[model samples]
Target: MTSPLANPLNRRLLGASALALVLSASGQAFAQTTPQTDETDDATTQLSLGKIVVSAGVEKIATDTPQAVTVLNQDDIDDTQASTIGDLLDDVPGVYTAGGASNLGQTFNIRGMTSNRGEVLMLVDGVENYFEGYRMGAFFSEPELYKRVEVLRGPSSSTLYGSGALAGVINFTTKDASDFLTGDDRFALRTRFGYESNGDGKLGSIIMATRPTEDVDLLIALNGRTSDDYEDGNGDVVTPSDASANSVLAKARYYIGGDRKHSVWASAQVWESDSYQLYDQITGFTAFGTVRRRTRDEAFAVGYDNSFEGNDLLDLKAQVSVSETLTDQDGIALASSLGYASEYSYSTVQARLENTSKFTLSPDWTAFVTAGLQYYSQERRNPRYKADGSPLSNGATTHPEGDTTRYGGFVQAEILWRDKLVITPGLRIDHTELSPGAGVVVGGGSTAVPEDATNTGYSPKLAVLYNLTDYLNVFGSVAHTERMPILDEVYSRSGTAPVNLNLDPEKSDNYELGASLTLRGLATSSDRLNAKLTAFNNTVENLITSASATSGYFINVGEAKYEGFEVEAEYATRSLFARASYATVDATNETTGVLLNTRPADELNLNLGYVLNSLDLTVGWRGEFVSGITNYNATTGAVSSTVDSYNVHDLYATWRPRSGSLAGMDVRVSVDNVLDDYVKNNLASFAGQGRSFKLSLGKTF
Candidate 1:
């Protein structure tokens, strides 16, 4: 299907159709808000939820995994300028980034997996975390309310999760009462003022509080940010500056009796927002913005877990959520006769239960067994009709509305030997059934195609971790996974379907090895100084893409693979310290022999900190670079070219003075896009943020 960005009436909203040729790859924007620390800094390395308690798959695991996963803790995110997961993802290697501050329908590509037909899968506490539509891009989600981010790179991930995970999985784990389990009542408040280069003004805030009652614990978090349109490096106001979002997260947990051995945990959250697309009202618009392009969303969930006798583990979790999102210019038209239009929405409800046990299987080994089941229901609507009488909704046909039901079960086993070797093998099987589209039957007047497809798939993974020395550990892993097309692909009435659903599900296999090393003993005396590095090759078959066909749908293309390497290291010292990490990814189409159109090949991160007398100072820098790309036409070999390579650098500094009477107060200054790089890093359609600075004061109690 043609992109709304290509529509002449909507062209002004984005740049020119020519740039669309370039930005298809979701680009990454990574900046450093905190400085690196030396090994000496280890003496005071604070261990909190940010450092551990990672939620990667269908369950929570330690950050120390056999795969390439990056854990961004709450404290790090708290101090960073990034307001959402999209902002923080810019620094993670092998991950392509895109969308400005508020591009709801945008998607991210990890490895060589990206397209109008999405391949990436994102989850919030094991839920779909998607817009109403199956083909809808990443649902608009605010990051300030989250506890951490877990990104799994490459296919072969199924061991627990199934399809829609071809390239990777991004799990936005929310904060809970357990995360704030400090001894006393605590509260922290932060507020900031922002100014866009294109000329918009706004304010942002982050608030958190925890209270412990007689037998219960409560935690609360709040964050809000708003801004105006911004100009490019050349002084061009890319879009309207009006953007706003508000979110609240709360959790309550109670202890049984007084032993604290048996406790129950529950949590809930609400997120809502209305934003303006930063673009010319007249030039580029899919639909006019009389009412402004807007969307709304919300979610709620609760669960319980307890540790019992015999080292056995039992857990039960149930959650349900409803979300609605829409984008259109119903009352407002960018072009008079050429006025454009479109609307999309996603709503979902889900729940699941999981159990695991650790028991002695032999004299020399122990075993871990896990089992789980999940259910989901989602509805999507996309109307591509125009303001004036038009024959089609999205360049061709109108999208049908329907809901899909998905259910699945999984089990895994892990065994350890001699306290030096560990092996884990896991499997998951899924069954998905699409609720028939009774609204418009397929083959009706040839305007719509009726498709009710249901299929089952399997996911398996095997990994080995071995301790080679007292200070180092090495590991290797291989896994097979799959990705089933979303409801949008089988039934996108928008006529964007380049191919039809007869296409097979996408599948993948990954091979990798890496190591974790502890170096404080050899380096300058410090409590903890560690480093990790990994390299791998992952290839996918039948990669899905919009194609040219009679039944317009998605289908597997020639083989595509992503080969890359990553290195992330941190050192803390008593007086001063620094930390840095980088990744180089070569995502390419093996059939066409070109770099994956949307992914970058290089990234860099560095941070430094100093503590003197009663004051602490820090300097941080992050740089992201990318090569160019190639776009193709099914009928032709090479159709067009995209953005060239670009690099961005940022700096940040903050001071916390000794506070005897002040209790808790601090000031900070940050310079984003420090060089004012003017390159249009619009991953594909949306514009990018430019050089801007922020200053603020905050307090904690």
Candidate 2:
């Protein structure tokens, strides 16, 4: 399945985005001044074969990439100065935030789509970081350790990656020891402490270093924390006693640079994502306590990328990896006096390669084409059946088995038509195999076979940039994307149909047209002001939605359409900076003709920051107004679960002492749910966290 780009809603994202860009500009301008570079960092950013890369976001490359991408750098992390994975995600437009009720597992939503359903992909270095629970969030890695975050938004990304890119990709790049390591005996450390209105206390520290001739680079980091249940303005306890945890991360990198351009490196990690919610209901605030989960995950691999100069100039890279995760979920419904428990074990092995060359077709144009293939396989298990935290017994015990296989290849090419115009078009094709174990009845019951299916999908994307002038660009794009049904979807088939496949691939088209304007900073600004306007129309085919109310089986309703606009603007100067974004979505279900459930129609984000040599403080807040929504019963024509509009806020600050050698060291703090809004998040899923605060310290040597 392939979707076309939204020609109408493209304007919406561009328009709403302006609100964020404006605040970001001013925020940076007021923060601090260093070198005369494209960034606000103390170190200058350079361009070369592989000059130190800024993954947070690569500007010209971001604009030139065939897909729509966003970047949030370490500075952005520091400015917002967040403590949890959920806090950093605010920079991403169209993404839904979760896990606020507890610091356990926060889920992210993209384009009104869910993550951890294997819909979105999260990669750290080269390993997948996200796992499944009731909710989804980043792996147990410290955000302060990151250098940058790149978000590739959309299924058109499937060609580059396989299974999970259905909603696009989030590539998290970690800071290399050498990038910050200094002196023959390198060493650096950071410590932090914080307090919250909910009686939450946090303390942590990290230490890193390397040995010159020992052929070993070592890093050690840890985070220890504690928190209590919080009461919102409405006077209700959100999840409390979110099990405090002690986490540690270690790494070792060896140098094999005998071949100069030829080198190989590998790393491994084992971490825990655990949480215990003391309260049951956060929506209206529940009295049910004692909810918990624990996930032990480990990923380790070795890969090599070698470059060779030949007639065609080929750069070859390949890697094979084995990763596994074990998750234990436990919950007790106080009212029902029911305790439910289940576990899932997953292991995956994958390999991939790519070859690319730049061709000098003509004096006025250049072309680069890339081709690659990736394979992924996994085994999953689910033993008990439950609905809305309630036990459901039919045939008694249920053990479901499932595995996935994906083989795909894609090629992207760019044509530079003179110095001002560029065009990029890419296409990918994939073949997938989905197989699940048959179901058996408990204690000598009947046995039934589960159906399996194979599918082939294609994704294509195109982006054009026409530079009206040196500082302005007008661009347009159209693309198609798709994703096969995931493991859970196949296991939970509806109505016991004698079907080969339970559902069709979800397909969508995002069309866009937008413009960017760069203006000179007004004050003693060493930076530039940016303004963007975009309108877009997003159409999804075979939109699949499930419900637990009626043994919620996955079903395809009909076509769904979402149209919107976004505006983003920013101003960066030496003394002050500001950035802001605003988005309005008009989403509708064409068949039933009702507002899409949980799809917010209006959203706004704002951030303002200022840096006073010894102290760099920032205040930021985001507001989302979920318009009224109703669920329609296909046969009865009855509407259920009506929701109202609401808003949320957050505040952050950082302090750096100028007098001591601790120049690069600073303290950062943040408070989420400032107003303590008691907004019912997902009625079927769970509630959100109450007002909470976190503090962290960072240093560079």
Candidate 3:
């Protein structure tokens, strides 16, 4: 079989062709309103062009950010009725998930970089969620706990997020008590229930929000879910897909100095699941046999914010957070041969202090400078036990234990000239050190300790955006960043490869160009349309990757190149809305000219909906199309088997009443995979979910 969108040149032409048509059509429309930096009200802030991005060092509207960015609000999250966090982001352009059908195995991929390689940064309420292990995945949390998610694509984010953000950054914001409070009401209680037919999945949740004092607000939420193994489109049961999980979220906020400008807040979240499943969660089943596994993930954070109302140069925010993820497995059928049951854990502690200064530089120039300092420490541990419940004498080097410490400081400056041109420049410096755990053994059972490895790197970026006209804007950016080695790459010295102490940091140079189009008064006087197209090229030097288990351990090989394009457009009115996005990426190893397997297939997502104000009802249809890919190997001049293209469609309806007897009630209904077509994500290891009907009901008092 042959793939249609596999050639790099063809993909580039496709993007160019689409862009030419969009530009031509937009030129004929007249501009009605000019864009502004003023923030929109909460009720109307969900609009794609009006939404503000808090993850950026200095908040800016998504369209004015000069990067490929996406923001999903609470409404979007609820409409999907997603079971896992990954499901909430699957439709985002340039984003994909691997690890197959099990929720526990889902991991995120951006551009062509996987999260396991520390290329993509994941954060929850400003705290890092870092975990990497064999056959396991990253980011295990409840999607119901979050109200907002922000995705900033490309290496330009490295200046604010971290050094390893070669692909991008994703930030999840938790819900607050204020989100549930209504006028004159000091307390609120909410109950929600949901069911899915495909896997017989059931979910129950309860939340309480209260204001004990005029200066304090508090909230607590509890959620539970259970499901059996689900069937694929062919009606075949996908083994090890059963799930039983519980989660809790608590948050509080307090005002100080009788002024809300000075406030403090804290939050805690915990999620856990215990069950018996296959030893290999990534691909489902293997010769390793099944095991009794229990997994726990927890995060806690505290923050302080002061507007400094009288001081224009002292607006400040500070935070400290800690997180831990642990997984334990016992009663393994192959415990004796594998040397025993084991426990794997990753713990992190982090802190950040940031401030933004806004001032006028001249009559025609306005500027804002943001500076921040961050520090984080992570530890990884793997302990094994004998079949008889005794400690193992020899440790496994395949997953060694280690500790990594990193600290960084960054500064960004944004300057606007006459409200038509914006320029942003940023710089960051980070230092990292890796230390092997005590008594850890490596290749050939050697006990000799190795010297600690340390490295320092810097990232710099510059971006410019110019408004060509009232309804069009062009932007370009250049960024250079670095990524330090993680614990696994530095400590694990197994599989016939010796320890390498001279490992160097991976460096990347990324470039991006894009255009934004905004038009109004086309279909109706109050309707608006917004679209953006972005093209990016990145080169990574000294790329770090595994050289196959039989050959060597993780090593810094030659360079790799990644190039891609993303197109996003949205149109909305009082009662009608439509959105569409398309994305494609091509990545290859420069040394052998072989296409990288991490590159995902081209994807297009579309949503069309209408609202009926009289009945307080909304209905929508969503469709997703994915093109297949064929891998190429230059060494042997061979082409690998291809993955067939597939398409999935969904229908949904939602009802919410604001007044009368049905006030404070919400109901949602959705049918997924309506055609029951056999589907498999190009990057996944197993088949996709089959046709299913889902219902969710909630009531607030």
Candidate 4:
């Protein structure tokens, strides 16, 4: 069967081609008017024209990185007024979050790759966020706690972030005391209250910062939210959807010396949620029950950063962190006297040390080498029992207790010539070991025991970037990445299914080509345009696939291929802003010659905003479109489900005083799904939220 993207005249193709043409033209025009220079400061000035992303293995501007990346800063976050991380990421091209409106059971998909036993990695403040069971996927947190969010698309990140980052990485950075307090200010406080109509939810938060001394700063924040069951687009209440969540964050920073060249910081966050769960509406599970679910996520980290004052060549950073997640489910059957409970927990401890050394070989040549060592250990435990406080006779665990340890070392070099061309080459070696706990009894009989496995992988990456001009750049990258089979993929079982400890690691070779163009002073004096076009192709060997939804056993699918492209553009002025993004992906199984059912057909986003400067007000409109998709059931071998195309619109307005007595006060109002569209997600499992309204008020002192 022919794929939709195979058609040359497809809108996604045309849009990408048009963007590429514009980039080429802009590059030529800018190149003709400027001459290349060797001053290192000039390169820094050019790259600092936009936000810098530190997660790209180095601190550099997004346009200068040889990969596709998306960054949302504080201003962008405030404009959207989102409550959840999923909501903030909904409009990003090539990104999708499953599970509809609920935060639990949510999964993330990048390009055409979904989570096959943890392919995408999530990080908070550079520490890993781990999950154990297959049913519960990604982590969820309130958006107010984050100061910035960065997403890296593709397997290129595997060189720096091991195993789980085979698809990509998403990092969230929280706020600091210095962000709110001025030089002389000793304390700062901010508070917010919000309400949403669909779920009748209420949100409240308070953030406090204090500087006890010139060398010490502390920050603390608390957020709470509660909501009833929300209605779908058809005005039907989704059962077991009521939820309540609370989160707290604390951080402290201390300067080690008077010069402040050496600094140490500590931070911690705790988030807890209580919700109700029911069998998926489409699953046809006749067993009805009232399930009380609770989840707790905690993270803590300490880090030190130092740039040797006497040694101009060395910069060092070291960090250690621990994170844990626990989930419990308690339920009672409606028709039967049966009752049940289950608990799953996962924890990770990690440490990293890195050093960067710079060298000036000659006037036109300079180089920097970064080397790092990382170590992490993961542990998971799952237990099930009856409501009568007795262990299940079957003794079969949902997810058995397991432990995994990973150690890795990597080095990368960046070499630049005349500040116009840059090349980076890197390599990483990782060793992983997995150990499964004792066997469990099932149906009064012993189940199959799990075996231990150890694996080693070598990843290599090469990237090149050429500056066509200060405002336009073209880049390409090729990487070979490997992912070891996770504990769930290797040891999970159902009934008598044997553990799959013999499974081989999944490996992929990824290639990417892209261009970035920035045009300042386009028409108006304050108008600027930023655009990006990226194309990628990846092939996987020994792809891991689930044998059945009910059975936890997995099998290798031999080989598969994925190809995709994304286009994004944003135009902004002092008072007006507009943005558009589009993406398309194609994935196929080589042996069966069938398309993979992991990705949506296509996605597009459009947003426009205007600022009434005199009145301190801003108004915006946003629209999103997702093409229809078809999904096949691996177990049934049939077209099990289909989802129709959907379009949603949102309108929002915000007012913030810039001066006078109301100076730090803000008020916002927003309406989502203005058309009341009856939209279903690509998975065809849950309907989208109906038309909803939100109002917020905040003040800072």
Name the best candidate (by lDDT): 3
**What C-alpha lDDT do the candidate models reach, one value each?**
0.57, 0.56, 0.81, 0.75
Which prediction has more favorable lDDT, 1 or 4?
A: 4
lDDT per residue for candidate 3 within 1-701, as digits (tens), equals 23334454665566576667666656666655434433352223335656788887678778877999999988888888888777899889999987746566467889989887778888888667776656666778787888899999998888887898899998998888888997767999988899999899998999999988878989999999888888888999877778888999999999887767899999899999887676765644567866777889888899999989889899999999998889888876766655568887889999999899998889999889999999999888777888888876333565667888999999998899996999999999999998888545445345567678898889999999998887788999999999888766766675466556666789999999998887766666666667899999999998877653433366788999999899988777778888878899889988878888789888878788888878989999998877877766534648865777777889999999979988989999999989887777767766878999999998988
What would you estimate as the lDDT of candidate 1?
0.57
Candidate 2 structure quality by residue, lDDT tens digits, 91-122: 55566564344445555666555555656777
* RMSD, every candidate, angstroms: 8.7, 6.9, 2.6, 4.3
TM-score of 1: 0.82
Residues 577-614, candidate 4: write the lDDT tens digits. Answer: 77778888888787776778776668778888888889
Model 3 lDDT, residue 11, Cα: 55
Candidate ranking (TM-score, best to worst): 3, 4, 1, 2
Clashing pairs counted in every model: 61, 72, 0, 0
Ranking by lDDT: 3, 4, 1, 2
Candidate 3, poorest ten consecutive residues by summed lDDT = 37-46
Cα misplacement distance, residue 116 of candidate 3 (Å): 1.3
- Model 3 per-residue lDDT at 83: 81
Model with the higher TM-score, candidate 1 or 3 = 3
